[model samples]
Every structure is written in C-alpha cells, then in structure tokens.
Target chain A: MTAALGQSARSVLACGEVRTCLLPSFQALDGRAAAQLLRLRADEHVRVSERPTMYALSPEVLTGVDCRLPTSNGSKVRAVGTVIARAALTEGRLLQSTAYFSAPAAGPDTRRPWGQYLVRPGLVEPFGKLPQQATVEGVLRGAGRGELDLGTIAEGLLTQLRRHALLDRRVPFKSRPTHLRWVARRQPEGERASLTNFTVAEGGLRTMELRLPEDVPAAAAAGLCEDLALHDWLLTTVQQMLDNSRIGAADGPSVVEALHPVVVHLLHLWMPRAHVDAALGHLWDVLEEKPGFSRQWEKLSRRIRDRLALQAVTMPHQAFSPR
Target chain B: MLIFAASDKGGTGRSVTSANLAYHRALAGDDVCYLDFDFGSPTAVAVFDVADAREAAEDRGLHAYLIGEVSEPERIDVWAKTEHQVLRDPPPGCGRLVLMPGDVSGGEFATTDDNLRRCVDLLMKLYHEFDLVIVDLSAGRSYAVDMALEATAQPEMSELTARWLVFHRWTRQHVAAAASLVFGRRGIVAGGVHRGHDEEALRGAIRFVRAAVPDPESPLWSQVSPTQSAWMRKTDGDLKQLASTAGIGYSQVLGSVPLEPVLQWREQLITDEDVLDSQIANQETWTALSRLAARLTDDKYWEEA
Candidate 1:
C-alpha cells in the first residue's frame, strides 16, 4: 500500500476478476467454519463480521506475474508486478474469490527487484509509459495467450479454497459458476463516481467498466464491482435455472424442482450495495436507472415465490415434498 | 456421478464410446461433461465433432490446468459448437453437453501432488455442475489412470459416487490385457488400494465394456457357410470361457457394442438420424450404447457380485 498522499497523487487503472459459486456444502457454514474454510495463509488472520450479515473475508495473498499486457489494438506493453487475491464468504452460502491489481501511469524502463514488487501489494507497473485506454479495454476484453490473465489468477485461488480440507465438497444444488471481469478508470479529484457499462455476455462472463473519482481506493472499486458481480451472478444463475425449468412448457413438479433452491439459498442474497463502500455506493445508481439490476432481481425472486405459491395452491402435498 | 473410461490398449474405441455415452446421457436430460484426459493423444474433440475447439484450447486445456499453467480448463459446449448437423439443435428437455479437451500437443507426464489435487478439484467441480462426468483416461496404466485413482480416493470425494469403465476390443489378447489391467497385481484395484481406497469397494466400482464385438447371429453373416458359422460360434464360446476363467465374466461386463462400420469409420456420435433416417449405423449398436449409458448410474447394475 502506498502512503496516504501517494494514494491519490497519480492516476491508476484498476482491474479485477471475481468468480462466484455455491459454497459446495449441504448447508450454509457458520461464522467459525467460514473463517476456518477461508484461512488461506497460516500467518494471516481472516476477518469475520456478523453484524450486517455473516461475512468472512480472508487475508489478501499475492501472485507474481511478469508478462505482456493484453491490448485491444495490439500495442504490446510489458508489465512486472504482483496481483493480490483474496476470498470472501457471504452468509456462509455464496463464496467469491477476487484477484485484482492496479497499474500506475508509468514506471522505470528496467525491471525492479522482486522485493520492490512484493512491498506494493497489488500494484503492477508498466515498463514504459502506460496507455491507459488500451490497457483498460484489453482487461475488459480479456487477456490473450502469454498475457497477464487476472481470471486465471483468480480461478487458481478459488480452486485452492474449494479444495480445502474443511469443505465436504457437497452442494445443495447444481449451478454453473460465473466470472465477472471489471475495469475502473480513475477520475480527477472531486468528481463523481459512475458506472459506465455493464455487459452480460455468453458463457457466464460479465464485464463492467466504471469511472471512479480519486480518494476512493482501488480496493473500494474492486469491492463495488464484486458486489455487482455477485448480485449479477445471482440474477443470471436464477434466470438460467428458471429458463431450464421450462415452466409452462414442462410439468409443474419439474418447474418447482428447478426453482426450489433459489428460494432456499439465494433469495436472501439480494442485498445490493450492502458491502460496497459508502462513496462508491452511489455509483450503483447509474445501473439502477438503465438496466435496473434490483428491478430484475425483485421480479425474478417474485416469480420464484409466485410459482411456489401457485404450486401450493394447486398441489399442497407435492409442493413441500422433500428435495 | 463420475464415470472414468480406461483401456489397456489403444484403438479400442474407448474415447468414441465414452463420448457417445455422454451424448446419450445428455439426450436423456442429464447434463453431461466429457473430459478428455487422454494426454498422449487427445481425440475427444474428433469424437464430439468440435474440431474448432481443439485449436482454441491449445494452451488452456486440461494439461495447462493440472500443471498450474492456467486456472480453469477451457470448456466447449458441444451442442452449440459441434459442426455435425444432427447435434447442432438440442432436443427439448435435453441437458447441456460440454467437452473439456486436452492440450493439442500435451504428452503423458508423471503425476505430481499438485496434479492430483487439480484432478480432484476438477472432478468435484464437474460433479456439482453436471449430472454425469465422463473422464476418458489415456489407454493403459498411464499417469491419467494413476491420477484418477488417487483423486477419487481423496477424503473430499469419499461421499461422492465414482465408477470405472475399462474398454477393450473382443479379442483374446485384448480381453486378457483388460482383465489384468483391472484385477492383476498392478491393476486398478491394487493401485487404488495402495492409494488408500478400499479393495472391495474399488473392485465393485469397476465394470468392463467390450467394443467391436461381432455378433454371430446377425443377418450380415447369414451368407456364410454352415461350417464357418459353426466355427465362429465355437470361437465365441471359447472366448467367453476364457473371459470367465480370467475373472472378467458376464457379471463384470456392462455391455458390448456390435461391430458396426459407422463407429469404425466415423468415430463420431451415432445420432438417431444415422439409424432411423440415414440407415448408416446398426440399430443394435445404438441399443448397446443406450444400455451402457443407462447402466452407468443404475445401482442395481453396479451392485457387488
């Protein structure tokens, strides 16, 4: 971490990838087990809070990557630095792993010592002048072969956590994992933070481009994106589940079978901006106006509940049958 | 449920047959994932008719994932990506069919602790997302087989159900080699036991699939002379006796595919169009594959004998 003055002195581009999936347990974990499950480093401590919700976040770990940056226009810019990764468990049900790094406007022509990179936890410096526009677009487009891949680093950390001995590797339901790639362009001081775009692509990939004012740390932007990613994943996953159910096209029992888990595990995870920083919380308003994430979520959750209610009214005995 | 397909020798149609089984499961409304673990020569892409995916996953395949070069292996949705006309449009209620191809140039390598862990992680992830996970291992007692054995024996996988399908051709040498690969001193049972699996449980979890078996009663052989037919019957009886004596009897056999020219030449999925419309593949071949796919998770079929 840089000094307080240095944090806002220069313009930095921050990018990250977050993977969200079910915790792979028959039941949601408690605070203690959640902490134990996310204890990635032996010497570090896992922060757990139960006030707002059962949340346990692991200490940040670093993965060193020295490779070429992915550019939209094929501008090859080499970078050398560490990528910080961390895991978080929300309400002991949904697990997320985020790997992110910030890059300054420019750096020395020659590579610095490894220790120098380690001290600056999540800062990746370009060899020469950094083309802010190309790098941000590249990250949103995804890295090419031999380029620095934030998704790979994030997935590696998630894989490590999913294989922890503390987990039983049993999931309550079947749902595909989702990846959200995000890039935040730092704005001048005193400017308002705004979300530029949120695009949902095929193959469970979602990209977010944002403009954040100075004084809000890159980590906070990462947090806002993570929150957005988690909720978007929930929406995407639940929608897919319903679509696969073939509600009117299929039988009532099958539709209920498909929508049952969303009611049990994910219905309560709709607290958007609950974990995002106060300053960045306003940025969600941009999305609230156009696509309306909360609006879509409320509608989806209502459909699930209404289906259950309708099933109960029609077939009471089969509605609550053991799953 | 996880199903691993292995063979003691190559050219036994192990990869093709397993890919067909995955296709059948998906047709039956079960999300199926076919993992190409044949590191020496990955060919599931050819069987699934997803040729473009092979080049796309050159460096991000299972090899890269297991060796820690990449985080998650590249997955190709077969229904959406297959070039074959019949497989392009999925039937209603048909589940997803995904193929995780191996590196185009990856060769067999020694299994390390990290590799085994990655294998277990991949299997677990697939088990949670898909209804059936079919991992086609490299033929013979290669590192793929070793890694599969070790990964399934881990404690995290204890509660999950896994079964092994050893594929072989219908021949004396192939039968003997397949049996020895499962029951011999250095076979799967022994290897699993050495790697902390229960011997009886491991033995019960394995079943054999005989490919390219020529049925003597078929109409195609009706033109043969009586003497030739009698000799073929005698030879088939002799092979069955040999199998029983070698400990891979009828009870251990899941199903056998009739020698069909389509499977031999195409090495692709036998869609219903091939049988009902095109009349290119034999009906018996389709029936055999359907039975094999059904028996994969049928507890009655896998019961200890």
Candidate 2:
C-alpha cells in the first residue's frame, strides 16, 4: 500500500502536530471504553491492542484546506488538499490527537476539484514548485496568520473527544498539555530513516525533524512521532510533579500528597516505540542516547518511591506519638 | 475554571479590573488566558500594552473565530509582546499570560446556534489547556453575556465550572442598577434560567465586585471637612443597608477595588512598579486585586450564602 502511494507521486515532505493531554476522567478507561472514546467515524473500526500496553487508534478523518503555505523566505505558494487527523488513547489514561498532511514537490498551477483531493486521503498539493527547506523551517517555527494552521485542526479533534459523554470530565490533577510539531523530508529509496533534531521550547512546545526513505508511508511517520510525543509528555509531566512537590522545603505528608497522582496515573506510561513500525523504531535511539530518556525516568521513579517509602515509615509515628 | 466578567453599565471599570485580576493570577504561577469578548469596543490590547496584537487581530480575533471567518483567534503572549517594561520581563516561576483580542471592526451581534457551539468549543479547549479562562463580556445584558450563559448551560459544559463576576461602582444608582441587571426581569439569572441553567447552581456561582469604592476613613480623605466626612459615612451606611435588602450583601461580595488615581486616570494593569517603585498607584488597590484573584477559585468565597 505504501508503495502504491509512492508510485502515485513521491511525497517530498510530511509534517504534523500532536497534542497530548490527560483524558479528563477521574478513573482510567478500560479497553472497551478506550475504543468507544476514539471512534472518530461511525463506519470505521477503532483498532485496539493490549499486549504491550492498552492502546487504541482511531480511523483517519480528513479536513480540506486551501491557503498560503507557511514559508520562511516570504514566498507565497497556494496549496489545496485534505489534511488527515486521527486520535489515539494510551492505557486510556492519556489522550492524543494528531493532524498531518503529505505534500509532493509540485503540482499544476490551477486549483483542482474537491473530489480529486478527497480521493487521496492525506495529500496536500502545492500550486507551484515547493520550497522544501523553507517550508520545513516555517513548520518548525509554526503557522503564521492566514497560513495553514495544523494546531486548530488538531485541537478541534481533541475537544471533540474530550466532550464525549463517556468521559466523566474529572481530572485527577491539574497539568498543562504539550504540543509536538514534527516534519519529515524524503530521503533516497533505500536510505535508513534518521532523526535530525529535537528542540524543547517554552510553553510546552517541542519540535522534531526527520529524514525518511520514500517507501515508508507518512502514517508510519505519524505513528513514530506520536510514540515520541507520548513518552516526552510523561517525562515532562512527572518532572514537573517532582519539582512542585517541594521535597526539601515542604513537609513529608504534603510532598507525598503532591506526588500521589504521578504514581497512580503517569509512572507506568513510559513504554516507548511500542506502536511504531520496525523501520522507524530506531529513531528512538537518538533520544535515548544523549538525553537518556529512560535514565532520567528511572531517576524520577526512584525519587518518588523513596519519598513514598519515607512517608510510610513516618506515618505511624506521627499518627500515634504524643504531641 | 471559566470566569465571565460583566457590568450593568459602562465606565464601571469592568474591563480594566478584570484584566488586572487576570494579570495577578498569571503572576501567581497559574496559566491564564484572557478573552476580549467586549465585541463592540475591544480595549484589552491597550490595557495589556500589546500594540502589535491590535493590528494583527483587526481581522482575526474572537469575533472572527466565532463567526467562522478564521480558523483560530490571534493570541498575544503578554510577557513577550507587552511594551510595558515590568510586564515584558516577567518574574521567575510565572506562568504564561495570553490575550485573545477582539476584532477591531467587530460589533454586537445576536448569538446563533452555530456561534454558541463555537463559543463552547473555544471555552472547552481553553479549559483543557489553561488553568484559568477569563472572558471579559460587553457591559450590560449584551449578546456576549447571553452567549456565555447559553454555552455554559449546554450538557457538554455541565461538568465544567463557570463563575460570574458582576462589577459595579460604589454608589446608590450603580448598586441599584447592578442588582437589577442580575435579579430583575430579563436579568442574567432570568435569562440564564430561560436558557436551561439551574437557578440554584447558577446563583451559587454568581458574585459581586465593587470597583472604585471610596473609604471615608482613608488618609487620602483626611483633609475633608467634618461636615463632608459625616455625610460620607452616613451615605456609606445607607448603601450597605440598601445592598443587603437588594440581596447582594456582605457575604455575596467577593472584594472591592479602592479608588486609585492611576486606574481612574489611565486604565492599565497595576504592577509592583506602579505601586512601590513609582508610587503612583495605591497599595490598597494592589492588595484588593490580588485578594480578589486568589478568592476567585476559593471554595470558601463561592459557597452558598
């Protein structure tokens, strides 16, 4: 299928935005409820898996866009096509929705019929020659005014899922959501996919760049980015919890109370590359090597355990001792 | 949490005071998003000192987003975009302060089903992202107020917590007008109930904010003659009795902003520089606004009276 997509017209660039947040429910959803929440289409099926971790992936939905593509050089290039979006659930504890589109190098100058664009699920065709480098830089920076806004589309889907009646609308703790924007440029047919750069910016924004072979589908790229985003969110959120816990400044029970939610809802959600294709899973190596995602995670995990254990030892003495 | 700021009449300091409350909340490490829903005349851009946002939001603001003219409203990071020296360099550990300005040419328009849905969607999205979403509605019972009421009454928004802050100046006429705006026929309570809001729950969430209150005991008024001071005290007592009779008594009041020459002369956020360094704005005004910001989510202040 991916080969068929490549045969139609090799995509020069693939870019997407992923929004990761806590499912606004007090209790974590079971497998069945996860599927029901991620059912984006009435006719399509929501894939569910439980072996590695409880995860649900929704069918793709398309949004048509015809606007000026964001470019760094200020050159205006009109594009018109459908942007595909999908939602996923991890252990029913975290909810993520991604909006992405693939674009070829160039297309005819004139606009095409909406029906023609609808057939190709996630392909956006530029009206002229695509400025590959400029477009990649523009996407990494983010959409400007009157430019194609992937964040709105991604947020629209997230809002829809959060409003579903299945959710109880109760969050165990208050934490900010994270937005990860990723761009992948096409490499040669046989070259291995590589992760180029990853940047952590202010206000919970993360950007990543990748180079992938022509045979690997954009869907695989989206899956790989989603896995990376999920793990990044876990690390960011847990680190925040520990920082705000005020371990040395605040009292023992108070710090324990603050870290309670991390242990209950987030500590077990560190499985990386669980759903990415085998070809793209190696991208995780780049993150694991320098920053050592697992190493920092293990450190946080142990700190939380140590704090909880200290609380366990101090609870009885404090409760029964004379004041 | 969502907070709707409304006033029965203009010049009540509704917009400037609520903007200050938003500033105070953000300074205290809570991510806050302030929406300029005053569709007729948007002044938050000037208040927050984000002049660049004014030009960019002329065509794509909350009005454009609600009417479907744009995909998303323009957001100005107050810390990064503000021209004010103090606001430009936010203190460490401060949370994000975002402003969603209203369209320059936008005006009052009746709320339709589509507009209400979009409003709810925007609020829900902000709720999940920010800690506090402060929507500054146009004064009186306008379309903005109506839309906020109708949107919060929807089934999907039932689980979310929404509060109302009614601002009024401290005077006989202003107090009476503010009470009528919330309790009279076609008032917020009546209008909210007509649109499927539970009367008790809605009433529990409503609170009053008295702006520009004059205290006769303050040192600023020490030079006044004995006759004038006596008269001022008597009038203050009378207004208190009238407010209790009107059902917006002491318990119903959240906090009051003192009459500061700075806020009255130029409407802007009262930062620490304005209060301490420059000594232009009063310390009492700063304290009141901070207390009000903290009491916004305090259950003790919002409990049934």
Candidate with maximal lDDT:
2
Model 1 lDDT tens row, A219-282: 8987887888888888888887777626546655777777768888999878888788998998
Fnat across every predicted model, in order: 0.45, 0.27
Model 2 TM-score? 0.92
Report how far off residue A99 is in candidate 2 (Å).
Answer: 2.0
| Candidate 2 local lDDT, B57-173, one digit each (tens) | 467899999998777787888998899999999876677799999988899999999898889888877887688999999999999999999999999888789999999999989
> What TM value does model 1 have?
0.93
List residue ranges in candidate 2 displaced over 4 A: A1-8, A110-119, A245-249, A310-323, B53-58
**Per-candidate iRMSD:** 2.1, 3.2
Model 1 stretches with alpha carbons more than 4 Å out: A1-9, A41-45, A114-119, A245-258, A318-323
lDDT of 2 by residue, A191-283 (tens): 999999998997689999999899999999999999999989998988876664154445656766677789889998889899999999998
Error of 1 at A243 (Å): 2.6
